[model samples]
Target: MDPEGARIQDDPDVKVMMAGSTLRKVKSRSWKKQRHFRLLEDGLTIWYKSRWAGRGHSTFSVTEVEAVREGHQSEVLLSIAEEFPADLCFTLVFHGRQGNLDLVADSPEEAQAWIRGVRKLIHKAQTMDEKERLDQWVWDWFQKADKNKDGKMNFKEVKKLLKMMNVDMNEEHALHLFTMADKSESDSLEIEQFVYFYKMLTQRDEVWKVFQDYSGDGEKLMLEELENFLRIEQHEGEQSGQHAKELIDRYEPSETAVKQGAMSLDGFQMYLCSQEGSIFNPEHQNLYQDMSQPLSHYFISSSHNTYLLEDQLRGQSSLEAYIQALKRGCRCVEVDCWDGSDGEPVVYHGHTLTSKILFKDVVSTVKEYAFKTSDFPVILSLENHCGVEQQTVMAQHLSQILGDTLLTTLLDGQVPQQLPSPQELKGKILLKAKKIGGLEQCLDETLTDEVSDDEEMADGDPESPCTEDPPAANKKHKKSKLSRELSDLVVYCKSVHFHGFEHARSHAKCYEMSSFSESKAKKLAKEAGTDFVQYNTRQMSRIYPSGLRTDSSNYNPQDMWNVGCQIVALNFQTAGLEMDLNDGLFRQNGCCGFVLKPEFMRDATSQFSPEKPEGHQGYKPLRLSIQVISGQQLPKVNQKEGSIVDPLVRVEIYGVPQDQAKEETSHINNNGFNPVWNETLNFVIHAPGLALVRFLVEDYDKASRNDFIGQFTLPFTCIQAGYRHIHLLSKDGTIIPPSSLFVNISISELTSGS
Candidate 1:
């Protein structure tokens, strides 16, 4: 016998039925037919083919095994059992070289000895046939114990077997049994545990279900479900190429092409065709390939200007107009609330509301509209024109209704010191202060004043005071101040939330020129946990000359450019001279142009080539028509003196269209000029769509040149566009030099439909 066969002899519970062919007759005719039946040492047997031929021979041995309790087949059960020693009482499979041997053990030493015996048998086995036979012995035992054909033996079966032997078993006890018997941790049991655990727990119905659930369909559960799902779907999508193309076409329109004057869909399509390497080009297979990754930059709102709700709703009934404006991309909404006579906060810009729009109605409308769309993320800034008492109540009510989604300004009761915790609302809250006391100091002062007034009531009888006693008039005044401060704070917080701290500004000065102190403002922002530094853009521009001077003067254009760049966000009064500069002749000159020429007869000449030359790079001087203006003086000599005359004196250039001729005519009208006769006049001819024109003044003496003054460069592109009125004002509202001279210009591209 093999060493494994030897170990089986040591296992006391292991029974090897070795009744010969004659003794097997009482069992069945088929059982009796087995002539050469060799009972292996591991409680399994093999019968020679002749004896097994007429009999119904199972591939596995017909013996009761302990470990095959949980619905596992005999073959599988024995295969699992052969891995460990027979002493440990657990129904788990053991992966071993000689298949799974049944563990038959009642003690750790006995199980160890059985395991040693099996190992010795495997080591000594010389021929492959002998080794296979030994393996078959183990497999046969597994087949006998496996009650209902499942492939695994679980803890329940092991516990039941312990219970049958009057030995209690818990999870720990079962794990102990498993660890001892399952030498390889492959969830298999050896002979002793297999036989004992199986007989205790095996039931026909339960075993059958276990077998069906685990290996009935003969398919194993895969480990890479998520990866497989994604890969399969992606493959399918790639296979349907047109579908993928359609998806890209529906979204991700080309922003660059759109910015470059591609207005209509057809225009965009044409541009794509013309610019073969552009994003919209379908032939470029790599187009949108990187779109799966995130974009490097995105556009965010810097700041927003809003009209007060009361102002807008003054003549209207509902908020439809305001809602429409919001749809047009207004980021901020302003609502001015005043305390009513009854102390209710009401929305109105003026002292009285002529319309029926109420505060509650507006709130309801805002909430309704907010629910309708997820795209519009609007922040509401409530300008509390109402008294302190009313504003606090209104703010609290609004907070309750809107929850944290709506960004609100700080209210009287919402001071950081007063809050139970730092204000952690859903939306941001900005603390607003016009002066240098800081938000905390302001709130403290307001609270102190309240306490001081209440001192009078200290001596009064506690019960005598009415439940709703009217507040003192002086107290009311103090409360009103607090309310206004709270309202301002709330507005500031709302601004910060929507446009970030950088865009928020103090409105305390009411559009005054001197409200902003950059350093002080920045300090205040730090205290408020914000980084916003607000300034009046127009005031800053006017007071601090942008340092761009054309004449021989101390100036710095680069510094001016730096200042402009620093002002990433600015508030502009759209109706002012700055607006005019953006829209008028200054635009025609160039977006960066600030100065106007002095001469009535303006000439524009480019010393450089009209088109950029290949590799020919250098600075180009822009030459203009120069004239000497004499204030109310006539030149002493004309062409008779033979001196150089004022080039612009007697020029009579005509045939230009009415729009093109207006800039020169306007200049002449402002200067009150008509040249003398008999003088070979030179006029800086400024015509539409022309590149450059020069004028040489003749007949007029050199001394007379001083009398005719001022020089200007008329932008030909502007003249062509029919904008005849020159902008006399600069961005800071300063008048350009020789304000009498006018030159029309327009250069920025206009939207196709607009």
Candidate 2:
């Protein structure tokens, strides 16, 4: 290795070079070219040369190497579909478009060494990227804090900076940050050291950091102070004053309380990030519940018009949509298939100007990403606009791309008394299209008798351009038959027509599924709410956005989910309040896209409604008292020169609310660096378990709509119910380090409840 390249070579993880490794021409899958590879600071670099082959060197961005693993030599060679003969050598595999670089090592130990070294490099690169991103964020905040642009921010300037970032800083917390950033122990911080201050504030990321700031010592937490921090600082005077001591004892038992006062930062953080916070509760019982029940037993994450990136008409439909949906834990996705000009079936929003892609491409993409984010079964909600010939092609493509993963029969070959659980269908794909054989022919007797395999066809999705009502009895309408090739793929998820609660009970069988338009489902809820819940108990029901959602906006997923609709489908491409609520609800339970239904809704014999149940009284109205204390490193919207933003912190509560649901602080100007509102806002919540709190940071502008900086929304159950720092995040949901609001939150049962 050259002196300049020696740094990577000298890495403790790096070792003796191996022999017989070469780069494969991806399209050709050839190994004729011998190559040498090394890890550079930013990426993986490779060199190849041969007598007949052109010598070249190239580098792939570290992020481009999506996956790396040790591989079997002969098996790997055969699997890559290359023409290489079986060889008993060690191999390493890197999977991605950056080129599937397969390297042969001299020994198994060498292969392991390479795998370890590459993984370490990948991790280091990713960390560095994140740190760089944070540095840029800090610089932006720094520039905004120094309004005068004198290269440094004074104590007053730093204080204002904290307010802007939604951080409430006392003299002590502020000074610790300020003096540390000023290595000179000076009274100010240079712009260059702003990121250093940010690291100090966020690196520990322990609740104790903030707790200590509010305590007498910069380390020890006092009982009285903890109580006040909970009651006064958190605006939660109603909470038990001894709450801190209890949490400390439960989570950080290693540390005994002080003689008089008790608590520590470690204990508090453990509680905050625990299931108690409603954040990452992997141990929650709901997540580990029996996954062996039928698919309908879960509130599955679903998407409508998943192919369209924007508008249904004139919008571009791409495979990316399927990948995006699958990665987000969407267990079910819609595809409208029409005959393409190339004799293949194409997917798009039919009868519209939406662009199209080969149905095969969608299938391939699904196969790749279906289990990437979650291992739950994926349901393909097929909307057919194609004829029999291409429909067969579509089925063939699915069968080919998905192979054994596509479910073609009941797992146990027995008539299911109930639907199988997601756990049972792991790595499997189910089709939610209509069956035309014994089921779709309206031969009710066939369903009553021993069921035979049926030929299935595509169902008319509500938003499908070709969707139409069943032909009237008076009208002589010819029926279309599904080819057996495509029909065989519709195993357990056979889509069935539902006439109503009564019709479903009388005609629909257990395995057949139903789809309902929003209006129809809402009508059912209003008239036969209990009956609908009963119907959903044994069979699957899908609710899609009505045709009226032309702009691709979303309906309230909660409304349908409340009724136990398993597949409450939405336009996954759109983002809004409805989408936010959907994300929040499904974010739990491993984000597997299949959340178990509530006990009341899941009980087959119980009659339920979203509103007050028959024997139960309505919920008690609750009051939330939230104090907007101060912000630290509040992000500014893109502001022009000569202008500093006025930031406002809004506390918006979403749920079944009886009155106006939001309150906010008056704008604090020029203090984006450290905004201090010290304002208390209150709200009366009607739905406690169904409630969510969203904290938004905005740049206030008089002449224009308030520009959004960022926000974070989490279920009310996640709130720590004490005085804790509320970390702020970017609009896209990435955390903005050192940026958070210091606030007190108090929840009380309303006395006005009748």
Candidate 3:
């Protein structure tokens, strides 16, 4: 059981939840109906059903609930605000892309009771240790198997449960284990008996073999033996003894084992699955990177068409999207502003069927969540399609809603030679839009003639009209007039046209930046990789996805980061390999939404090209060897009964042209648990600093494409050399604990092939 859950039953909120209530489920203005919701006896699951919908009920685990928002935070709740009081409303936000559940209670007290109770349960679920989580998993399975609610599962039910769990066990062996666990002489097994039977059925023989290799006795590991294993396998040099003792104290379930300074097999498995055994270095988990560098020297996390929750064409525009992006530590968010009939500027994809949100609400949402995840500056990339009158409303909304958080004036009372550091401008919102003139002109006059920035509307953003137009056709696309009220708010990030490398090198101001479509940026990176790298050293550049991606898909952000592009914006709503790479690159630096570029990429005079990295000066290749040892509790790609997965591991390297490679292990037949492949894949990385390593597992098939199981990606620099476990994540980046790949990693300077 979880230590946090021990006290939860005594919580006042949980008591109130057990009593239950009839709450109004709010889906839209017209769809407000009463639903009876109550906490189950287990205290970890919530049961709900509509009074009218007979024989139809549903249950969601507390672990699946990510957060509970109070009052009108959700779009559904806001739609029926007049029908329900703010104090009586709340929303339950789930993990991944699951839609939120908005509800309204009869009283404020009842609303607070459900909100606080669910939050308590979520906290307990999140803080569970590896052993506790395993226990919970077993309990959940038992609940499913015991369909008759008799508190027991018979042999027939157990057989069905095994198939549901992706296991194809021999019937005779399963029967022998089940008979051993059924000590009460009854054919059916109780909850405790079921747990014992599961332990016998899923015994990790692979881990036992490893434990036997390290232990003198086949049962437990002594202090000296555990210390030796840590030094040799975990590379824990001087602190091996101390770390071993700490592990024994933390993981050893038996008090006798702790007193004897020994670790049982259970304790050893717990330690190996803990955060300390993760492939990522724990030291890099905190704010370990230098953050005082100029803003141009860092790669900023950005999102394109951030207001849309789905495809660019018919997506719903919601403030929740902005809140979600900011919570993920995205430093830049795009808002497409158009003239609304209500005299307020609206944000949505222009000339499309996407819904609209008030610009003021978006600014308000940004102000609330900008610094919640990181104390870094946020860049508001405004795609302005509104005229002067509505533009003033936008400026007023920004200034009023954001208040002191808005960067309306130049920092240090002067234009900077280079952009200010994130640390210097912490908690401020910077506007990245068209400015009529330089900083001097903005401070000097009330209005100036609008400058024609060709690249301004050519970003290929979902809202830009000429995004997909040909160059000849782009000439006929009229530019919107810039309002002095809006233009004056742009301080450091002034949108300007990109003439040429030579022109930018000579005439481009430090405060001026340009936006490029993915195609144009890729062309520049390939043709003049060195010049692009040099140019980015002084001025920032933003690369957005092509407008042709009507589905709001993303390009490989690594292509832009190779050229030192500061803000490589992608559709945050989409989840795939592209977003995985983006999440991997920014996972370090405390996830503060900024990572400094490599030393060569930061130096203006240094020559480095992503296309020809081998030719760079002082290039030294390093050899990386990864031993794909085994897998643990791999998930089934198919949920059908009796469907076991044939799992395989693929290791991919993403970097410069010469460093990109992929290697895979042979698939094991009909196994999703404890499949071993002691194959070592090797690679030579010329630019290790820019490399990202991805470990992907799939259900291999000969007749069709393999099904994705899970994957984990991280920067090569963050890789720790040792025997580590790669905890896999689902497609949406939520961790699926216990689903991991065990690997031994080694890195050394490249020598002659041997």
Compare the candidates by TM-score and give the number of the best one: 3
Candidate 2 lands at a TM-score of 0.69
Candidate 2 to native Cα RMSD, angstroms: 9.2
Tens digits of per-residue lDDT for model 2, 292-398:
77677788889998987787667878776776678678889998888899899998776677877889878887888899988889999898767788988988898
The lDDT of each candidate is 0.30, 0.65, 0.86
lDDT of 1 by residue, 1-754 (tens): 2455556555433322222221111111122222332334334433333453676443233222212222212222333344323234222222110122222334555334333433333343322232243245334445444556564455555444333322333568467656666655667665545643433322223223322333323222111221232123222223334432332233224544334322223222121122121111122222111111100010111111122222222332334433422332323344545566676666643333334345655565565544232232444544444455776676566666655555443434444321211123212322221121234454454532222232222211122111113446434334224433333334322111112223424222211112112232333333431121122211111111111211102221111211221111112122222222222322232121121221111111112111221111332222122222211111212223222223233212221221112112112212121221222212332222222211112222335332333222222332321112121223223222212221212222223343
Full ranking by lDDT:
3, 2, 1
> For every model in order, what is the number of clashing pairs?
56, 38, 0
RMSD of 3: 2.5
**Every model's Cα RMSD, please?**
39.8, 9.2, 2.5
Candidates in order, TM-scores: namely 0.25, 0.69, 0.95
Of candidates 2 and 1, the better by lDDT? 2
In candidate 1 the C-alpha lDDT for residue 483 amounts to 39
Show where candidate 3 strays beyond 4 Å.
1-7, 440-443, 453-480
Q: So what's the TM-score on candidate 1?
A: 0.25
